[model samples]
Target: MMTNAIIPLVYGLLIGKSNDDYNQFFEKLFEQDNFQPESIMTDYEGGTIKSVKEMLPNVLHKAVWRQVQSKGLATKYREDESFRLKVKKLIALAFLPVDDITTAFDLIVDEFDEEADDLLEYFGKTWIGEPKRRGTGRKKPPSDHKL
Candidate 1:
């Protein structure tokens, strides 16, 4: 079961062994009364990201990452000018702290334009690093491709 919460106002239980299971869980939550939420912050799990995008299309989804000691592999890549810049931009986008999506995007743009290297590095080390994947293997494809 995957649980998501927003303090006193909102909390959700997403019971599932697979992506479809959680998708159904979220669908039911949306149907239920008193379940509206402004935004959701979650670990950078790909399935959760896809489910949130499909189910809560209107809600703000922020990917959260915890600080961890780096293996210095990222630093090795830092020597490559283009790769460093790309990583810096992505890291900035991933780490900007804001209450909502708009502010987060704004911060990312501002930092990117200003070339805030320190901020980008801090974000890279803490939040913008590679995400960990959880759960089982991929789901079976739907019979029809066209919607």
Candidate 2:
């Protein structure tokens, strides 16, 4: 996402099932006209994280809790009054103009440190190259997958 100089802009949510699939998606994103962002905030997906670090090392990265809140199971923060109020505050904080995107991210990170830490720890344990069994050689049909 492109943003005015006063605020950070974020774009795209291309999820993939494998590292190669994720790489191809990011390649497409990079091909869009001058789509280089100064920073990107994303969920802690291993393939995406690896791709971003390797492909855009200079960009700032901030991991957000919304990613975890939305994964696997449905999240009900939207239905709870206090949670809704907290989300409203976060949204307002996110949109406030800052000197740069980094500052904006720092604000976000600071505001949600507990949630962010939980997400980071979860990511570190789940996605960072821990050993796993390779399944049988049957490949799933493309139509059956979304990522």
Could you estimate the TM-score for every candidate?
A: 0.34, 0.34
Q: Positional deviation of 21 in candidate 2, in angstroms?
A: 1.7
TM-score of 1: 0.34
Residue-level lDDT tens digits of model 2 in 1-147: 766554535455655556676778778888889988756766667677667766675453343244446442115344555544443444333234433423343444454435345543343233222223485222232222122
For residues 38-89, could you state the per-residue lDDT of candidate 1 as single tens digits? 6766555556655766676545323221211142334434465654454444
Model 1 stretches astray by more than 4 angstroms: 1-17, 63-147
Judged by lDDT against the true structure, how good is candidate 1? 0.47
132: Cα error in model 1, Å: 29
Q: Residue 133's C-alpha lDDT in candidate 2?
A: 42
Each model's lDDT comes to 0.47, 0.48
